[model samples]
Target: MPTVIALTRFGPPEVLRPLRIETPRPGPGQALVRIRAAGVNPVDCKLRRGDFAGTDPAGFPQRLGNEFAGTVVALGPDVPADGAVAVGADVVGSATAQAYAEVLVVDTAGLVVKPPPVPWEMAAGLPAAGQTAHTALSQLGVGPGDVLLIHAAAGGVGTIATQLACELGARVIGTAGEHNHDYLRSLGATPTTYGPGLLDRVRALAPDGVDVVLDLVGGEAVTTSLALVQDRHRIGTTVDRRAVEEHGVLRVGGRSLPALREIVGKAATGRLTLPVRTFPLREAVAAHRLVESGHVRGKVVLTV
Candidate 1:
């Protein structure tokens, strides 16, 4: 049996509990991994709390985790054994919703070799956030001379997006609390406090006006971006669905394999950084609660 973090019912963070289940075998083009760390994402918390529509209660004991870092233990038929999928190879990759366990199977196509220099906690945290940042920036055509605004810019996705934007020769204006402003500055973003008069503050920073906006915090953030950037197609939101429907703003964010590979390579050379807070796997409740707190500096991870 393998122990995994699962929700016995949909509710608060407390709903996440450990369950024992038979270890899953890899199918063709898949690899079995012994997870060393799993990334605890915001979506996992949302699903557990039943915040997202269309969740069925019949899916109780549902697992929650989309990214993990570990070592390959076995390969399924048709998985090439000479590469990152080989047994004993350390790897990191995305999953569906089954990563928060001691062992689980994931598609071999998703796996990237974990550079020895990257710690397990950091590697576990990369795939989802890194890919989302990469995809959103590309979709928005973020480029040189552009002034990009990223809401909630100190969290997981924002952190990655800020650095990637800078790498693309774009100037970044990142919104965070006063406390995180200095941290955002370290990432090459012009930091501004987000709240009342956000538009004025951003206008003060970029008198020429913003060229793009990536909203991680919903509500007024989208409204603020709408005011700063004239191109509706350049304004994107990862969290707000209503704003997308009502305002026609692009709903942006998703995983990309090529993006993750590039991000991992940058991380390997000490270029990208994502600070992590870790807890033992059994403390997934605490992990979820911390993420739900909405103030974590970078990312949260469960160490197995």
Candidate 2:
């Protein structure tokens, strides 16, 4: 048996409890992984709090977590024994609702190689945020000379998006807390604190005007972006469904294996950085609380 954190019932972080489950065996095209680290994402918190209660059909005791990094402990019968995903290969991937466990089965196709230079913690943090940032930038067509405005730029996805935008030759203006402003600048973004005076601050930073806006924080940020950029198509968001429906700003963030692979490669060479706050697997309640706080500098992860 392996212990996994499961929702006893949807409520606060206290609702999460460790439950023992029968060790899962992989079927064809799947592999059994012994998880070393799992990323704690905001969506996991949303699910636990029943944010999507009406539309989500999952019952009680549902598992949380979408990204993980670990070692392949066993391979399915049909999986090639000598392939890149062998018995002892270290790997990382998105495993919807299943990564917060000691062991779990996942499709081999979703796994990306964890390079020697990338630590288990960083590898675990990359999948969801990396894919989301990459896809969002692609959807926005970010490129040379574009001034990209990233709201909540100190968070997991924002941290990666800031670096990727700079890599694409764009000038990134990231908004975070006063403390995180310096951190954003180190990643090649012009930093500004988000709030009442945001519009004026951004105007001063990029006097030529912002070419694109990627809003990670909803609410006022959406309205702020609307005023800065003229083309609604150039304004995108990972949050704010209401804004998408009413204002026609593009909704971003989706799975992209190629993008995940590219991100992992960059992280391996030190071209990318994703700071993580680690907690023991059994301390999942604390991890969930941290993610729900909305003030995490980088990423929060559970070490299994």
Candidate 3:
């Protein structure tokens, strides 16, 4: 039997409880991974609270977690023909609400090799935030000479997006609290305090006007982006679906294997970095609370 953390019901962090279940066997084109670490995301908390119940209703004892890093313990039928991954290989990738367990099965298509130097905690945290940031920047056409404004720049997705934008030669202006200003600057972003007067402050940083905006915080952040960036297509949001429907701002986020490999390669070569806060697997409730608090500077992970 293997232990998995599941939400007995949709409510709060306390609903998450450990359950012992039979180990899952891989199907065709799948691999069974002994999970080393799992990432805790804001969406996990949302799902627990039934935030997306209209579209993605939960079944009782549903698992939580979308990304993980671990070692391949076995491969299913027809899995090793391409030679991309094999038994005992270290890998990282996106999972579907099932990464918060000791062992789980994943499609080979979604897994990428985790570099030797990248720690399991960081690798686990990378998949969701890394892919989201990469996709958002690509959607916004962030590249050389572009001035990118990133809301909530000190948080998980924003941190990766800021570094990736800088790597792509964009000038990044990131919004964070005053406490995280120095931290954002270290990641190659011009940090601005987010709140009351954010538009004016960002304007002061980029007098020519922002070329694009990646809004991780909705509401005022989207409103600020509308005032600062002229083109709606160049504005994107991961949080505000309403704004996307109303203002035509791009909705960004889809996992790409190429993007995952690229980010992992950068991390391996010391070109990209993500800080992670770790807890043992049983402390998933604590991780959820930290994420829900909305003040964590980086990502949180559960070690199994």
Highest lDDT, which number? 2
Flag the better candidate by lDDT, 1 or 2: 2
Top-TM-score structure, candidate number:
2
How many clashes (backbone N, Cα, C below 3 Å) per candidate? 0, 0, 0
| Cα TM-score per model | 0.97, 0.99, 0.98
For candidate 1, write residues 177-216 as lDDT tens digits.
8999899999999999999999899999999989999999
In candidate 1, stretches whose alpha carbon ends up further than 4 angstroms from where it belongs are 53-58
**Candidate 2: segments with Cα more than 4 A from true spot:** none
Q: How accurate is candidate 3 locally (lDDT)?
A: 0.92
Q: List the residue pairs that clash in candidate 3.
A: none
Worst 10 residues of 2 by lDDT: 52-61
How far out, in Å, is residue 147 in model 1?
0.4
Model 3, residue 29: what's the lDDT?
90
lDDT of each: 0.92, 0.95, 0.92
